[model samples]
Every structure is written in structure tokens, then in C-alpha cells.
Target: MKKFIYFIFGGVTFILGTIGIFLPILPTVPFYLASGFFWVRSSDQAYQFLLSNKWYQQYVTEWLVKRKMTVRQRIQILLILFVLLAIPFIAVPNTWMRLVLGCVFIGHCIFFIFFFDKKRTRQKISSENKIFFR
Candidate 1:
């Protein structure tokens, strides 16, 4: 049962991470993190493969191991979210609520970009199991 959950998580993460490589709108690290988290639980082979992969490991593992994000990565994340946040505001038909949402998104994005550290603070807390076992 636990392995099942890990497999699902890894599969989903790998899929989304793959998509994210091509689509800037999607985040690569989060999905890779999901994949790594699951892969670590289910299969050592899978986990090793993921960590050594061409692109997945670079950003994801840094957070996994050192809990740090390279400066370039955070800039990219900020830019991506900034652009994505603008999309709904441009498309939505509702005025008042849309305005509210726009304001909220703007504020949230601002706060997130200002406060979150792509290397350490932005990432989820490390799982002890991943550290000790994987």
C-alpha cells in the first residue's frame, strides 16, 4: 500500500516535471520533488535514476540535500508565476471579483517572491526517511 502511493507520486511528478521542461508555466522542481519523495520510498533504482537524470536532479536534489536554490532558479520561478498570475486577470469576464482576485494574486505573488527562498524556505521540510534511508 505504501509502495503504491510512492509509485503514484513518482509517476505524477515525472510526468508533470517532463511537461514543465517544455512549458514554462509549469514548475519543474515541485513535480521532481514529488517524484523524488515517492521514488525514495518505493525503489532505490528509481530514486537513483531520478537523482542522476539529465535535468531533474539539478534543482530538485539541491533542495533535497542542501535545501538551497540557485539564484537563477528563483528568478525563473518568480518570472513564471508573475506571468501566470496575469493570465486569469486577462481572461476572466467578471469585473469586481476579478479585480479582487487580481489584487490578491498581485499581493500574493509579491509576498511570495519577496519572502520565499527558492533554495531553503520555498521547499517543503525534508523527510527523515529520505535522509536516513535514501
Candidate 2:
């Protein structure tokens, strides 16, 4: 039952992420990452499928293996997230609401800056669980 729920949740999130690729307001990578998380917990087959997929790999599996995004990818994702988060901050008429949004924005900024380390070198992803440098 838990596995079934996870599979369903993962499918839904992955669909949302795919739709997000076409819609500016929707976030793409995050949803797929969430889907990958649920799928990984639900089934090894699903996890392996996602890991083998070239396009989907970037969303989560690559991060799992590498432990961090490449510097360029991190900068791009952060800048986009900041801009999207700023929309509410700029458009909201209420001062207190804007302040709250400001805090949320700051929190995300801090998270991306500190939570993820920079990828210094390109590592060869191995067939095994371990990662190695070329």
C-alpha cells in the first residue's frame, strides 16, 4: 500500500514537472526531483529507470551520485528561483505580506548558497554505487 501510494505520487509529480517544461509559472526540476524521491522509496525498478534516463537523470539521480549540481547549473537554478519568488514580493500590495515573501526569498537564497556544495570536477558515474573521478 505504501509502495503503491509512492508510485502514484511519483507519477503525478513527474507529470507536473513535464508540464512545467512548457509552462513558465510551473517549476520543472523540483517536481521531478520530488517524483524521483518518492519513486526511489517505492521501487528499485522505478529508481533504476529514472537513473538510466538521460533527460530525467539531471533532476535527481545525478544529484544523488554527485552530491551537488555543477556551478553553472546551480547558478542558473538559483537565479530562476529568485526571480520567480520575487514576483510575489514585487506584485503584492500588502506590506506585511511582502515582508513575509521577502523572508521566504531570503530563506531560499540561504538554502541554495549553503546547503549545496559546488561541484569542483566532473566525476565519472560508475556502474556501481560509488562515484569516481576520471
Candidate 3:
């Protein structure tokens, strides 16, 4: 059943997100977002819980309502990518392997940071709004 799947996803996301909080490479926010959505579709309690979470409330709150990302979030994501993806290549022993992995990682980050993140789009909108409103 769909509901069962959501419950399972919610549990997994919560666990992974919780782990992400402690481990820098794991990324807690995305898992939280995933779990929260699962909860949203599956149970009112889960939706309410995610919405109420003090750590996650800000990102999901305005974004869910207005579909925006804050400037701080944008910067944070770039920083995370730099730390997690870029740094790892230095340790890779094989030159070709390093190059390939680095390129893939760069591509992934570029796509996610540029195309996927709503905050960047929101920033553009807000900037345009400022120009028009001013």
C-alpha cells in the first residue's frame, strides 16, 4: 500500500536525517524533507511533527507555503558541497578515478545547486521584485 510505503520512507528518512545531524557528509536536511513529505502524505501527525520541528521549521515552512529558499540556505548548500564533494577527490589515489569522480561530483553539485534548489530561484524572484518595487 502507498500509505505503508510512506510510513517506511518516513522512518528511514528520519533515521538518516538524524544521522546526518551528527555526520557532516550524510546531510540531515534532505532526509528530513523526504521524511516530512512521506509523513505529510501518510499521516497528519507526521506532517505536524515535521512542520513543528524547531530545526527544520524554517526551510520547510516558508518554502512549502511560498516555495522559496533563503540566502543563508543557498550559501550553506554551496559550502556543504565544497566540503563534502570537493575535498574527497584530494584523497583519491588514482588520477583517472579522481578526475572522473570529481567531474561527476561537480556535475551533480552544479545541477543540484543551480537547477534544483528553490532558494536560488527565489532569490532571483526577490531581486526582480525589489527592482520592480523600488
Candidate 4:
């Protein structure tokens, strides 16, 4: 019964994550992470499937393991965040709210640029070289 409930939660979150890929306002990572959490608890097959998924590899696993993102990925996420936040930033009449939104945008930009390191570590470099030379 516990496994069954977890499986259901996993499936639902996975579907939401998939939908999030096309919808800029909806966040993909959190849902995908949640799906992975539930799936791992519920079923090995489901967990392995999530591990093998390209989206999971691109968005979740890389961030989890390396704590970094490719420039393209960062840019893509920032653009989507800007588009989604711009509407409220423009429409809100209160000066305080607008200021808050501006801060949020700036914070996101700073976080993406400074916090998410772009440089590849030596471990990653050596691993890639090994694969390439083989």
C-alpha cells in the first residue's frame, strides 16, 4: 500500500514535470526531483527509467552531481523566468511590488551567473578525456 501510493505520486509528478518542459511558468526541476524521490521509493524500474531519461540527465542529475549548468541551459532558464516575471512586473501598480519583482529578477540573474559555476572541474575533464581517447 505504501509503495502503491508512492508509485501514484511518482507518476503524477512525472507527468507534471513533462508538461512543465513546454510551459515556461511551470518549474520542471522540482517536479522531476519529486517524481524521482517517489519513484525511487516505490519501484526500481520506475527509478531506473527516470535515471535514464534525457530530461532527468540534463536538468536534475547534472545539477545534483556537478552543481553546474551549461551556459545554454542557464540562458534558456533565465529567458523563461524573465518572460514569466515580466508580465507581473509590468502590470502591478504598487511601487513596492514592482520593486520586489525587480529584486527577484536581479536575484535570479545573479544566482544563475555567480552561484551556478560554469567551469568544468578537473575530474570531469579527465573523465571526458578518457571517454574520448577510448
TM agreement with the true structure for every prediction: 0.59, 0.62, 0.56, 0.80
> 2 or 4, which is superior by lDDT?
4
RMSD in angstroms, candidate 4?
Answer: 4.9
TM-score of 4: 0.80
| Residue 31 C-alpha lDDT in model 1 | 86
Task: List the pairs of residues colliding in candidate 3.
Answer: none
- Runs in model 1 deviating more than 4 A are 1-9, 63-67, 70-72, 95-134
| Top lDDT hit | 4
C-alpha RMSD values across all candidates: 6.9, 5.8, 5.5, 4.9
TM-score winner, 1 or 2 = 2
Q: What is the C-alpha lDDT profile of model 1 across 8-121, one tens digit per residue? A: 789888999989888987778788888988999998988898978978756565554555555676666666776776677678777986778678767866765545555445
lDDT of 1: 0.74
**lDDT values, one for every candidate:** 0.74, 0.74, 0.75, 0.85
For candidate 3, the per-residue lDDT at 78 reads: 67
Q: Per-residue error at 78 for model 4, in Å?
A: 1.4
- Candidate 3 matches the true fold with a TM-score of 0.56
For model 3, residues 1-134, the per-residue Cα lDDT tens digits are: 99889988998998888787677788776888899889988989877887788767654555454555666766676677766655666776778877887787678667655664666777878899999998
Task: List model 2 lDDT by residue over 54-125, tens digit each.
Answer: 657765556655566677876776677778878877887889988887788788778766556443232223
Residues 1-134, candidate 4, lDDT per residue (tens digit)? 99999999999999999898888767789999999999999999999999899998877878756676778878887888888778888888788888888899899998876667545465677899999999
For candidate 1, list the clashing residue pairs, or say none: 68-119, 69-119
Model 3 spans with C-alpha error above 4 angstroms:
58-91, 104-123, 126-134
Error of 2 at 15 (Å): 2.1
